[model samples]
Target: MSYKQILYNTPPTDAINPSLTTTDGTFRLSTIPKPSNVPADKLLVRVHYLSLDPAMRQWLTAKRSYIAPVELGAIMRGQSIAQIITVGSELSSKFKSGDWVVAYSGWTEYALLSAKEVEPFSVPAGGRPTDAMSVLGMTGLTAYFGMTEVGKTKVGDTVVVSGAAGATGSVAGQIARIQGAKRVIGLAGSKDKCEFLVKELGFDAAVNYKDADWKKQLKEATPEYIDVFFDNTGGEILDACLARANRDARFVICGAISQYNTSKPKGPASFMTVISQRVTMKGFIVFDYAKQYASAVQELGSWLAQGKLKRKEHIVPGGIEGAPQALVDLYKGVNTGKMMVEVAPVSEALPSKSKL
Candidate 1:
């Protein structure tokens, strides 16, 4: 069978942001033979949805990162949902044909994935199959671990989050509230997003960084002093948060979206505050906590199932053709929640046989 795949070629140039362009180049639809090594226990998935995250930009660049860079002329890496069209020889124990599974299948329409490479999720959860990739997947896990572990937030403590309206930040703020935080403050670039953070997401306060008096407003909004700061956009915002941190506060550096595109990365200017406040700022890669992923996923799933948590996802439709642009949109702040692309429809087939 023939399938479409998106491949990246050369790296970006000085004029172009590789994240936005299919630098290298994009292979629209390419035909390739099906893998002959399919185990009976492995299922073939026709990818339906793919996630576009800011991390993808880092992956596109040939730089050291938590994950390896996408090889030249290979399919652009991404997380996707696919339906089982064929079963592998080893599949009889856990999964069967026609099951829907999430995998790191990249921007391809079809993928030959083993059961170990994918996880089964019910389609249309909260009315979309992509939610699994958003709130129920890595995004959710990031928020959960960043808040519970890195931030170590406690009741009656003030928490500030940069990139407040974005996927992980939005979820982190809400999780802070659920965990008994006294105040949850969000900072974003636009007025609309600030309003949404305060009105819809239940943030105690939302500040628009675009305002001329943003620094003053942040100080006023967080008068009690921030006990924990979850920084997603590391730049001036990070510096500002450091200045306002209370003694012994924790700063979780989840990402530096602001610095990703810059030619020369800048460091926080207010290092002196760390000495005065005795702050603890630590950077974490989510995979470092992989040993606890199952427990985190289970607890997060339970919260979603019981309506204790809400998820937001910005889904771009089309197939692998849409993957490149979706990744570019992430840096431009075009996505409000977890950014993802819907490659195709999810599978609705039921398993005909079960293995013990």
Candidate 2:
């Protein structure tokens, strides 16, 4: 049995520029032997979509972080929506073949997943199963928990979100409004994204950081103090928000994409604002609230069903080969919404497990 896979060759010192490592290669797309056997507690799955995330960049670096770096020659680590092709004998009663599941299936076309590692999910009515990988999946869940639990946003409070056009930020800004924020403002890199955030996603206001007068525009948009700041791009934007933070503000640091690739990371220059404003700032990882995933999913799904929540996906077509460029594009801010790689289409008929 053989399947295609993208292997992480080594850590990227700067960024994922394929040309810089073409000789030795930072990531290699190759076809290799598939799993011949699955343990009784494992299921064989065919990956249909691979999630493209900023965190993938950090995972490629050989640094100490919440998770281990991808090992050389190992399949690139990625969250994926897959279908169970062959159910292990012991797991037949729980999950049968053709059941859709989500897992950290990496960049392989097929995978052997531990029963504990995969969760069976039903595709939403009139929605693609890939939706479960984006807005209805971890991205949405991250926004839910980060905004509500971490930010502790209150009614009549002004909320500001960075990376407003992205998967988590777009949902975070909307959730804040749903949670009773008086005003919701977003900061994006481009004018089109700013328009999408305000017009399409229902953000009260959006600021394009690319403009020379963006700081002035942000200050004008947020006339009242910022009660909750959803910090996604933490370098300059976080500092700017801190300067305008209201007394006793809440700052939820979901990600720091601006500093992810920096060789020399530095803290915000306006650090004293936290003390002066008595702001509560906390950083969190989505996995911390794994037990509450169901509740988050239910709310997000309901929002999606009622059209209260809108989602967009920039899907790059190609199987495993497209993953590398897709990852680089994510960091370059080429995607307007949730970015993903379409590995294959969802269908009932798929290859069965191959026995050794």
State each model's C-alpha RMSD to the native: 3.3, 3.5
Tens digit of per-residue lDDT, candidate 1, span 20-121: 243344333355876756765567777877877667666766776788888877887888866677777677666666666778788788787767778877
- Candidate 1 contains a number of clashing pairs equal to 13
- Show where candidate 1 strays beyond 4 Å: 13-42, 123-128, 347-356
- Candidates in order have lDDT scores of 0.79, 0.86
Query: Global CA lDDT of candidate 2, please?
Result: 0.86
lDDT of 2 by residue, 227-281 (tens): 9999888888899999999999999999988888777877888899999999999
Candidate 2 colliding pairs, count: 0
True-vs-predicted CA distance for residue 284, candidate 2, Å: 0.5
Model 2 scores a TM of 0.94
Error of model 2, residue 289, in angstroms: 1.0
